[model samples]
Every structure is written in C-alpha cells, then in structure tokens.
Target: MDFTPAIKLLNSCNTVLILSHHNPDADAYGSSLGLALALRGVGKEVVVANQSGKVGRFSFIPGFAEVVDKIAVNNPELIVFCDCGELRRVGERFEQEIKTIKCSTINIDHHATNDLFGSVNLVDEHASSTCEIVYNLLRDAKIDIGKEVATALFSGISGDTGSFQYSSTTEAAFRVATELVAFGADAYFVACNLWASRSLAALKLEADVISNLKSHCGGRLVEGLITEEMYNKHGVDSSEADFIVGRLRDIKGVEVAVLFRKEDDIWRVNLRSKSTALDVSAVAAKFGGGGHKAAAAFRSKMELESFHDQVIRELMDLFEG
Candidate 1:
C-alpha cells in the first residue's frame, strides 16, 4: 500500500511524539528509533518512548538510550504509533492521552489485529514486520538512512522474524536487508547482541522451562508454563521468559507450540503454528487477542489449571476443524 499519507503527515508535523508497543520487542525499537532518529535529522522535535523501558539487547541500536519509560506530551501536532496492533498494546498509561489527542495520529503497523486507530492508518498485515513498513515510509520521505538508521531497522526485522528463522521472513524482508546493509547496518553486531548475548539467567530459564514441557494431541502440540516460582528459581523475570515459545516451537513433530506465564492474577499466553491447518490468530481472537497466522497470543483471567484446559481444548478444535 502507498504510504504517502503517513509521509505527508510526518512532514507536516514540527514536534512529534513517537510510541511503540508495551513489552517492546526488536520491531518496536527498530521502527520507533529508526523513525525518531530520521525525524530528528529533519530538525523535528521527536520524543521516542516505550512504556516497557529500553531493552538491553537492543541497546546496540542508535538512540536506544533516548527511549523514555513513559511519554509526556501536552499538545503534540502529531503522534506516531509504531508496531502496536492496538492502543492497549502500548501500555495502559497512554489510554487517557490517546483519547484526547487533538493532533493528527498516525498508526503504522503490520499486525493483523490493528484497529486503524490513527487519523492516518498505515496497516500492512502482509509485511514481514512494522520495521519494513517504516522503512518504506522513510524512503518515501527521502530520509537519509545512515548507519544507525540501517542498524535500527535491521534489528527490528531480525527480532520479529526470529532472526530470519520465522515464517514471517519474506523475500521483501531480505531485499530490505540488502538495502540496509548498503546503508551501513551492522548485521554482525545484531547477531552477537540480539542472539548470542543471552545472560546466564536466561539460559537457566530456558532449561527449566524445557524440563517442565508438556505435550498433547499426539505430539502435534507442545507447551511450557513459567510461574513466579520458576522465574525465581531461574533468577530471572518475565522478560527472560520471552524465548520459551521459540524453544517449544523447535521440537520435532510439533505443529502448535504455546508458552504461558503466570503474571499476578492473569496468564500471558503465546501461540505458534508450524502448519497451515490452523489459524492461531483466530484462536487468540476467541479470547479478545490477536496476531498473525503463524504466531499469535492472548491473556487469560482463569486460574492456571483452568486456562490450561481452556487453551488445550481450543488447540484440539483448531486441529480437528
């Protein structure tokens, strides 16, 4: 889709507020900082913020230090939201400001569940990641994407596409990679930090989660649950648990993989499908959640056992249907 409206809107703004999703991932930082730095290059007063705070792994990206833990804006002429499927995905703190945003709001994302909340909504579900969309916007705006710009974009692509291992990796994504490299993106740094730099705590979390893995549907599905006890034992927190689903998805003979984390009174659910026989996003939507076909997620209010049973039943239906 043409990103002219977003380009024009961006060019028209003087001071802009840029925000990314909660629990920010590679794509979140990639798109947010890539756009934020580029806007600053054009002399725009830019505020790049993520409610989850800056992730250490992504600190290699330029402008990562500037990503605020919270956004503070009184009356921005433009508010640019990147990579979030819904406003709530950006964290609950933004709810009041988002409602009263008298300025033009721009929503640019790749999530299938995006609600088109922006005055200029640029949602391309088929794109490999929102970073891809942001890349195009930068190109259209004729921004000079130097080394840092390329690095931020590449980090996002690598993050969301599972370092080019996920099904979301597309030919276009690779093409964009080539262009970013030409613009001086550091691929080796991305690999070393984003993938190879896992802490001891993360390794323990992975080992513990795998030891407790469960399987069902005759091995077509596998799951792992991380409770506060497990996190405490591993000397990690929910942030380190992000890799659990990837581990489960690697098991042989598994078509669907899930990872659940008990956080307070709710369970955070993550889903992945290796086969086309299921649309996991539909499964997530059944519980007011949304994502892509191969990957999706939702939250559960039921007790751990109850939510486990409920999700397993849905997985069975997805297979049978």
Candidate 2:
C-alpha cells in the first residue's frame, strides 16, 4: 500500500489527535498507540485518546501509560483514526468533535466494512490487523522498528488472528510477525501478556459464560447469553465475558457462534465465524454495526429471546439460499 499521501498529511501536521474505537480490542489499542509512537518519534505532537474501556491486559504494550481518555488539544492539525470501521465508533461525544475538526483526517483500518470516512483512508480489508497496515506505513516513512513498536504491532496481529490460527492469518501476516519478532518483540512477553495471565475470577467467569451456550440450526450455530445479572453474580466486568465467544466459534462443525451480552439495557451481540465463506460483517451491517468478516458485533435493544430468534432467522436465510 502506498502511504505517500497519509505520510504527507502526517508530515504537514504539527499536532495530531490519534484514536480508536470504544470497547477497544488489541488491534484498536495497538494500531492507535503504534501510530502515536511513530508520529511522536518524528517530533509530532500526538495525543492517543480513547472514549472508554480500560487498557487492562494490553497495558504491557508500550505507550500504554500515555493513552488518555479524552482529547486535550484544542485544534489538532490532523486526526488519525485507527482500527475503527465506522467514524462514530469512539462514542457520541468524540464523534461530535470530529465532525467539527477542520483538518486533514486519516482512517486506518483492516475491517472490510470500513466506510472510507477520511480525507485519506488507508484501509486494506485483506490486512491481518490494522497494526499490520500501520507497520507498513511506518516502514514507508523510514521509521525505526524498535522492540516497543514490534511488540505493539505483534500484539495486534496475535489478537486479530487468534495467534495466527484464524483464517485471516495469511502468509504476509506471518512474514510481518517474523520481522516484528526479529526486531526484539519478546515472544514470551507477548504470549504471557495476552493469555498466560488469566486471573481466577476471569476463569470462573469464562466457565459461567460457557455454561449458557445454546444451539440453533441443529447445533450448526451456537449461542450464549451473558446477562447483567450474571455479571453482578459473578462479580465480573464486561471484559471478562470475551473469552467464551471464541470457544463457541471453535466448536466442531459449528459455522457461526453468537454471544449476546447485556450491558446497561443494550444487548451487544458479538458474532464469530471461522469460515471465510461466511461473511459475518454483512449480518452485522444489517443491524447498524460493522467489523471484520470473521469477527463482528452489533448492539440491540430488543428482548433477548426475540433478538436471538431474529439472529437465527437471518443465519438460516443466508445458509439455505
């Protein structure tokens, strides 16, 4: 990908506001902070801001301490949004501010559903993660590939690719991972930071969440519900509910898996599919949400059973046709 225009835009700016989506995943934080570190390396004034969700386990990634929850700069000369499929992903307040920013904007993302909502959209749907795209951009700018940058990029790749187990893990993705590793990204450190440090409470929450797994289409599609009641009972935050969805996706002969998690009266429907032939993003976009093909999500206000029925109907239609 030719990042000449994106680099020119970044080069022209003095102060830039860098951000990712709310409810950030590793790719979100990694791409946003990776770009932040790269921009800062060239003496650009950069602020890496997020709307919500604690960095949690991703704090091991460099530039974690400097991630701010709000934008402080009055008039940033440039704004770069990373790993967000939609421009409104950073929550309502941040979206409002973005509408009024009269500066060059760059949207960097790997999701196929991205809307190209930037002055320069550096979107590559085939890229394993947004961090992969960012790594190329950094390379285009002749930025140094240090341990910190490598770890940040590697973390995103590990996350979005499920440690290179997902279908999105292409040969190019592996090559990039190899390069990042050679640049001093500690394999032990990344693995430990990503999965080796699960707390006992989190383990219990995973078991509880998995216990609710329900099946549709003769077990071809499985579902799970994590209600607020369950969260309060288990004394677990919403983040603790993430692990069970992938487990559901990996079930033998299951093509799609869904997790309906209730938070503040909203059922954030998380969907996962291991089959590349299955475009989960299409289903998610129908419900006003967007993401990668294998992993996507949407939020619904309908009653749990009604929404579950709707999801089943949609998947059945897609499959039977």
Candidate 3:
C-alpha cells in the first residue's frame, strides 16, 4: 500500500490509537511510542496501548510510563498497529475488537511472517526494525524527526538488532542510526542502561544456565535448560534468564543456540541461528511461535526432558538433511 493516503488520514484524525502485541519487546514499544510522539507532534491525539503490561527494562524509553493498556482502548478514528504481524498475536481477546473497527487502519511491521491483515499494510520484511518503517513513513509524510522520536526509533533498531550485533544489521540500519544520532538520540545512555545494568539475580541465572549447557551435532548446536528448580535455587525469576541464550551463541563453532526454560507447566524455547541456511522462524512456526529468521521462539506443552528430546531430534534431522 502507498502510505500516502494513510498519512493524509493521520493528519485528519482527531483521535488515534496506537497498539503493539502482547509481551511486547523493545521494537514493539519503541515503534508504537515513536509513531505516537510523532503524531502528537503534528497535533494528533494518540494513545500507545499494548495487550500486556510494561516491559521492565525498556520502561526507560520516553513515553513508556504513559502506555495505555487494552482496557483503555476506546473508539477512535484511526487505528495503527506496530511490530505485530497478526491481530491474534496481539491477544485473541482484542482480535475482533480490532477487526470490528470501520475506519482506515495501518499495520506496520518488519517480520517476514506478517499476516498482512491490515487495510493498509506497510509490512517490509527486509527492514531490520519496525522503527525503520515508521521512520520512513514519517519522512515520506514530511514529519520532523525530533529528539524524542529519534530516541524511540533508535531504541527499536538497537534492541531488535542486539545492539547492532545481529546479522540483520544492514547498511541502511546504520545509516538510520546515524541520522537518529544526529537528531539527538543518546546511544551511550541507552546502551548502558539496557545491556550493562544487569542485577545480581540475572547474573546468577546466567551462570546457572551456562553451567547446564549441552552441545550436539559436533558443537554446531548448543542447548541449555533453566529449570524451575534452578530458578528457585538461584532465587531468580524467568525474566532474568532472558540473556542466557546469548552466551551459548557466543561459543565458537556453534551455528545454532537454544535455551529451554520452564514457565509454569509449559516449556518455552528460544532459538538463535548464526547460519543463513537455517530459518529459526520455521522451527518456531511448527509450534505456533513466530519471529525473525535469526531469532525465534516457541512454547510447548511437553515436559522439559521430553521437549528437549523432541527438539534435538528435529534439529538433528534438519542438520542431516
């Protein structure tokens, strides 16, 4: 879709609602809030709402404290969704709520798996981040990229690309980052706060996860488990275990890295790949999960050991095939 008409529509809407998916990551909140602030800069009444609550670490991003939840969603002239591919991922409860709306809707995302469910889908699977899409939209509409907007966009870009370490980091991403910096985005501050400020509990979880690491396929694939017992022993929550998989991926000769954590009665699998031939999202989609090619996740009903075996078998088949 040509974003021109929707940009014009945005200029006319008095009240606009911006939304992201459930358990939103940095890119989701960043893109949503960036667009919200940009719209507000042009005198549009915009609300940034997500299906879930705050993502603790990313609350440092400006406008995060003011995020509206699903309950706050009211009838509005315009609806814009960011970083979410499909309405169902936003939360099944709000899918119909979103569909029933009769106004012009805009869907912006960077996921290759996007459902293209929007009346005006601005899905760019090649873009490194949704913030990039939003940035281009604002530029195409001739909107100014002020400090707040630049900061938010930078956060989304930096966070999703793993602070520019991931393979998705392209020349365009760096060019946008440079422009955002010129617009007064504080890269150092965001980098320090988001990555360097880990709690002791998180450190302990990291150590435990590393200690339990297992390798297979001649060190090409690595796996780690952070069980409930391990969490209790370390006195840390599962959220603190978020970065453990990165450590496994750091090991030399490891092409694929996976971490399995017990969340209540379910098993959550985080998958990462360093090889272009491997599409981790394909592995994730088998179990109803979806994400980018390099990084993907899925949830399973099987027990940890059972799920571990199943995943290993599947991965072995992929490697052998």
Candidate 4:
C-alpha cells in the first residue's frame, strides 16, 4: 500500500511515540530509531521506547544509544510501532499501556503475519527490510536524510538482509543503502564493528559449537547443539551462540542448518536454509514460532534428543517433498 496517507497522518499528529518489539534486534531497533530521527527532523516531537533497555551487540548504530527506557505517553497524539508484527512480542506488561493510549496508532512492518492492527499500516512482505520501507516513506515525505537517520536505516538494511547476502536482498535495498552511505553513514566502520567484534566467551562458544557440528543426510544437512554446560563452561549467555547457526549454513553443500540451544526448560531451535525452495518457516510454525522462508525459529519443551528426532523427521519430509 502507498504510504502517502500514512505520511500525511504522521504530519498531522503530535507527540509521536515509537516502539519496537521486546528484546529488540537490529531491524527492530534500527528501523524504529531511524523513523524517529526522520520524524524529529521535521520539527516533530518524538519519543522512541522499547520494552527492554538491554541493547544487543548490533545496537551500535548512530541513533541506537538514544532509545529511552520508560514510555512517556503524556497525551500523545500518535503511537507508531516498527518491526513488531505480532502482539505477543510486545509482552503483556506493555500491551495494556499501549492499548490504553488515546491516540491514533500506526503499524509499519515487513512481516507476513502482521494483521494490520493499527489504524494505519504500511506492511509490505516484499520489502527486504523495515528500514528500506522507512527510507522510502521519509523520502516520500520530502524529509531530509540526516546522518543519524541514515546510520540507523543502514544498520537495519544490513542486518535484515544478512549484510546483503540473503535472497531477500533486492536492487532497491542496494539503492537505499548507497543513498544512506552518501548521507554520511559509516558503512565500513559499522560493518566491522558488527561482524568483527566478539568477546572471549563468545569466541570460545563458537569454537565449541564448530567442534560439535554434525553432518547428516549425506552431508545435505548440518546440525549443531549448544547445551547448558557449554554456556556454564564459557561463562557466556545463550545469545553468544547466535552466530554459530549461520556459520553452519555457510557450509559448502549443506542445504539446511539447525542450531539447538537450551532456553529455560525447553530447546530453542533456529533453522536456516541455503536453497530458495525450502521454507524453514513451515518447520518453525509447526512447533510455535514463525519467520521468513530462509530463516525461522521455534521453541519446544521436548528433550534435546526428541526434538532432534522430530525436527529431522520434518526436514526429511521437506527434502523428500
């Protein structure tokens, strides 16, 4: 849908408040802050907030340090949501507060599952990243691209497109990226900081995960497991294992890569597919999670061995189908 009307609505509204999902990722935080920066550029009063202040490693973008902890919904005229598709991701604590707001609400996202919950929605599943959409929206509104806005938008583009390595990377994504770079985004420095920086504990976890990698289905599938012991031994949190699954997916002939980690009382499964025809979201949805075709995740209370068997069976069916 065209965002011209949404742009007009934003211009008319005052006291704009922007929010993203809980445990905000690069796309979530980047897009929200990028939009907020653009809104502020046009003499608008904007406040950006999230459910949690625990920033991820990717929060090094220019405007990222600006995300506030508390929500200041003092007679706000507009509440905008970015990169959050489902209400569950917003958490129940903030749900009541957000719904209680007496203002026009807008939901701008790129997820397929979005229900258009807001009075105005700019959901486009074909868009490579929410940042791409935000860039176009700001451009449509004739808003100047400042350095802070450019940096935040570039972070979301690079992150959601897997540094322009995923299949979803489109020509428009590159175009927006180039424009953002021209607007003073430090692409090289941001890339280095995001892809290069790693803690000693994270390095150890990666090493252990690599050592434990297993090949299956005649080298067509690769799987790795990171147990609670691994975390304890490395003195690291579960998020330190984030990069392991992507590394597994980079294997030469592997069509599918799976990473399993213990989360609380269940196993959290992250699946990635190198081939285009494989929709990993199907597998994730079967359990209780959902995502895109190439990347998806799910969680189950089943033991590791049982979960492995169930996943293997589902993937085998996918391959055979």
Candidate 5:
C-alpha cells in the first residue's frame, strides 16, 4: 500500500504522542515503541504512552522505561495510534480526551474492523500485525532501523502471528521477520522474553484455568473461567492467563474458545476461533469490542451464568448457521 501520506505526516510533525491499545500485548508495544524510537532517531520528539502502562514481561525491549501510563496531550503536533482497532481501545479516559484534541492524528493498525479514525490512516488488514505495517512505513520513509527498533518491531510481528504459528503468518510475515533479523533484531531475545519467561505463578494460574474449563456443543466450543479469587490464589493477573484462550482453542474438535476472566464487578470475555470461517471478532463486536478475525474480546457486567448462556447461544448460532 502507499505510505507516502503517513510518511509525510510523520516528517512534518515535530512532537508526536504514541499510543497503543489498553492491556497491550507485544504487538501493541512493539509498534508503538518501535515507531517512537525510529521517529526520535530522526530528531522528532516522541512520547510513548499507554493507559495500561509498561508491561513487566516486555521490559526487556528497549524504551520500556520511557512508557507513561497517562497521556500528556500537551500540544503534540501529532498523535499516532498503534495496534488499536478503534479509538476507545486505548481506554475510556483516553478515548474521550483524544476526541477533543484538535491535533492531527495517525491511525496505524492491521485489524479489518478499524474505523479509519485518523487524519492519516495507515491500515493494512492483510498485514500479519501492526508491527509489520510500522516496519514497512519506516522502510518507506527511508529511516534507518537500528537494533533496538528492529527488535521492538520483530516482537510485535512474532506476537500477533503467535510466533509465526497462527493462520495470519504469511510469506510476507516471514519475509519481514527475515529482514528484521538482518537488521539486528534479536529473535532469541524476543522469544525468550515473550514466550519462555512465564513465572511459576502464571503456570499455576494456567492449570487453574484448565481445571475450570467447560466444553459445550460436544467439544466444538470450550470455555474457561478465571475468577478474582483464582488470580489472588496464584498471585498472577489477567495477563498471565492470556495464553489459556489459545490453549483452549487448540483442543481437538474445538472450533471456538472463550475465556471469561473476572475483573472486579465485571468479566472480561476473550474469544478465539480455530478457523477463519468462525470469525470471533464478530462476536466481540456484538459486545462493543473489536479485534482480528481469529481473536477478540469484550467486557461484560452480566451475571456469570446468564452471560455464559448468552455467549453459548451466540456461538451455537454461529456454529449452526
């Protein structure tokens, strides 16, 4: 796709506020920080901010120390949103605040559902990850991507593509990975930190999720529940249980996996589909959430039993239709 417009916008801006989705994963951080570092290298002042703040597991990536939880809109010439399908994905507070900001905005994402809510939208739904789009943008801008920048971008691609194990992993994804590696991206470092660095508490939490797993529709749909008590018992947060949904989807004959994680008075529902034909994002969108075709999530305030039945009915309809 043509990135000249985005490149020009970045070149013209002096100060930029970079944001990613709340509860950011590697791809979100990767795209945000990677672009921040690259823009800074070109003498642009950049602030990387996320409502969820810096994730401890991703601290190994360069520039993690610089991430701020609160956005200081402070007259930034430009705002760049990374890996967020919609503006609200940044957080309720940010969404309201950003909509009032008069500055130019850039929306860079890989989700098909992106609303193109930017003065410059650099969205490519076919891209493996937002990091992939950012990588291309940097290359098109003729910006030299150093080791740190490459590693950050590589982490995003690896993450969103499930370390090149997901259906989104394309030849272009592998080609980008190869190029990033050549640019000094440390593949082993990203792998070790993102995949192999889970703590013991996280393992216990995963086991609990498995033990609580419920199969419906004759094993075609699997659901797991993680209560606040379970998180307290394992001393791990919701992020630690992020992998459970994928594991649930991996179960043989399971077409859909749902993870309902209790967060205070509400439950965060994470959905995953094993096949493209079963677009889980459609389900998430019904609950005011949006994401990629295979993975999506939303929050629910309904009683657990009621919500469970509702979701089962929804998925069963999808299955039957």
Candidate 6:
C-alpha cells in the first residue's frame, strides 16, 4: 500500500489521537506509542489512548506511562489507528466513542484481514508488523527518529515477529532492526524486559495450564483453559498467560494450539498455528473475529463444553480436508 496519502494526511493535521486494538499486545502498544512520540517530536499535539488503558508490563518503553483511557484531545484534526485489523477491535466502548468523532482517519496496520476503514488506509499485509510500516512512514516523511522513538518501534517489531523467530521475519525486518539499533534502540533492554521479566505468578499460571493441557486429533491439536478461579489462585490476569498459547504451539506434532480464557460471561479464545496450511484466521472469522493466518482470536458466550466441541469440529474439518 502507498504511504503518500497517509504522509500527506499526517503532515496537515495538528492534533492526532492514536488508538490500537483492545487487550493489546506488544505490537499494538509499540506501534501506537512509537507514532505518537514521533508526531510529538514534530510539534503536532498527540494523545495516545486505548480502551484497555496502560499495560503494566510495557512500562519500560518510553511514553508508556502517558497512554490514557479517555480521549484527551478535543476535536482532533486527525485520528490514526495502529495495529488494528478492524475498528471494533478497539473494543465496543471505544468503537462507539470513535463514531462521534468526525475527522479524517488514517489506518496503519499489517493484518491480512484489515477492512481499509480509514479515510487514508496504509495497510500492508506483507509487512512483518505495523511497526515496520510506521518506520517506513517516518523515514519517507523525513521525520527524525530519536532513541526513544526507535526503542518504541523496535519493541513492536521485536514483539510481533516473536523476536525474529517467527516466519514473518523478513529481510526488510532485519534491515529495519539494524537501523533502529543504530538509532540507539536498546535491544538488550527490550529483550530482558519482555522475555525475562515474567512474574512468579505468571510462571505458576503457566505450570497450571501445562498440567491440565487437553490433547485432541492425535495430539496435533492442544487446548488449555484458564478460569476466574485460576486467576484468583495465581494472582495473575490473562495478560500474564499470553505466553501459554505459544508454548502449546511449540510442542512437537502439534499443528494448532487453542487457549480459552474466561472473562465474565464470555470466553476469549486465542488460536495459534504452526502450519501455514491451517489458516486459523479463517476459523476466527467464522465467529466474527480476524487476524493473521498464523494467529487469530475470537470471543464466545457459549457454554464451555459447547464452545470446546465447536472449535474441535472446526479444526478437525480443517485438518481432514
């Protein structure tokens, strides 16, 4: 996708409000905060907001503390959405709030299922992550990327690509990382904080998930469940268990891994696949959710048994066909 339109739109705007998906991951916060910092450096008034508010684990990244739950800017000239596949991914509350704002919007994302909802869409499905696209945008616009901006952008790129271990890590991703490092993005600092800083409670939660793992389809499919009771037992929230699905996917002979996290009356299902043939995003879309081919998710209100059976059937169909 062309960046000219988005570059022009951003240049003309004075105040910008940036948002990302709800229950955000590293890519979401990294892309949003990186662009917000860069825009502020250029004298544009910027406010970084998310429906879920600030994530505690990401506080190491600069400007993480400044992210707000409320829209701080009044009648902003522009709104940029980063790392979101669709508008509703910002959550029901913010989705409704955004509709009241009448301004030209820019959508910057790397999700294959992006809806091109922005007035100026900069969706590049081939890019490794949204942070990679944002880096190019800043470079093309001749905006100076200082150390803080580099760290923010690098964190997102590192996160979405799974620290360059995932298949999405392209040659361009490496080149961008090299440049960001030269700009003083502390690679070691990011790695230590993201990977090595898991709390004891999180580790306990992981152990519990592993012990109760359910195998299906001859071990090609594995699923883990986390309930409110488990959270209370471990003293950790769903964010702490983000690593559980990845661990499940790492098991030998497993093609797909599923994680069911209970939140109130709904269960948020996260899906991860090791084989490209699986296309988990298609499965997610059946339940009104969308993401990349390898990683996708949706929420369900069905009873635990019914939801588990439905998901198993879907995976079985994909595997057998």
The candidate that wins on TM-score is: 6
CA displacement after TM-score superposition, residue 229 of candidate 3 (Å): 3.8
Error of 4 at 268 (Å): 2.9
lDDT of 4 by residue, 36-109 (tens): 88888788898888877657686687667778767866878898889877655565577878767787888888
lDDT of 5 by residue, 1-321 (tens): 899988888888899999999889999999999999999999999999999887788898878999999886588889999998888899888888787778888999999999999988999999999999999999999999999999999999999999899999999999999999999999999999999988999988888888878888888988898889999998997777888899889888999999999987888999999888898888888877878789989987888887678777787777877
In candidate 5, stretches whose alpha carbon ends up further than 4 angstroms from where it belongs are none
- List model 6 lDDT by residue over 198-290, tens digit each: 999999998899899999889999999999899999899778788889899999999999999997778989999997688889998998888
TM-score of candidate 3 to 2 decimals: 0.93
lDDT of all predictions, in order shown? 0.86, 0.85, 0.83, 0.82, 0.90, 0.90
lDDT of 1 by residue, 1-321 (tens): 878888888888899999998777888999999989888988999998888787776788889999888667678899999998988888777766577778888999999889998888989998899999988888988989988989999999998888998888889999998899999999999988888888898888888888888899998888888888877787776776787797788888988998988876678899998864688888889888888888888887877776678778898788888
Report the C-alpha displacement of residue 169, candidate 1, in angstroms: 1.3
Comparison by TM-score, 1 against 6, better one: 6
Across 1-321, the per-residue lDDT of candidate 3 in tens digits comes to 378877877887889888898777778988999999988888888888776767777877878988866746567888898998777777666676777767778899988999988778899888889998999899889898898889889999998888999888999999998999999889997798778888888888788778878899999999988888988988876666777887788889998899988877878899888865787788888778888888888887876766567777766666765
The TM-score of candidate 6 is 0.98
Question: Per-candidate TM vs. native?
Answer: 0.96, 0.96, 0.93, 0.91, 0.97, 0.98
Cα-based lDDT at residue 320, candidate 6: 79
Candidate 3 residue spans exceeding 4 A from truth: 301-307
Candidate 4 residue spans exceeding 4 A from truth: 264-266, 300-308
Clashing pairs in 6: none
lDDT of 1: 0.86
Candidate 1: where is the Cα deviation over 4 Å?
A: none
RMSD of each: 1.4, 1.4, 2.0, 2.1, 1.1, 1.0
Kindly indicate the candidate among 3 and 4 with the higher lDDT. Answer: 3
| Alpha carbon deviation, residue 141, candidate 1 (Å) | 1.1
Instruction: Report the Cα lDDT for candidate 4.
Output: 0.82
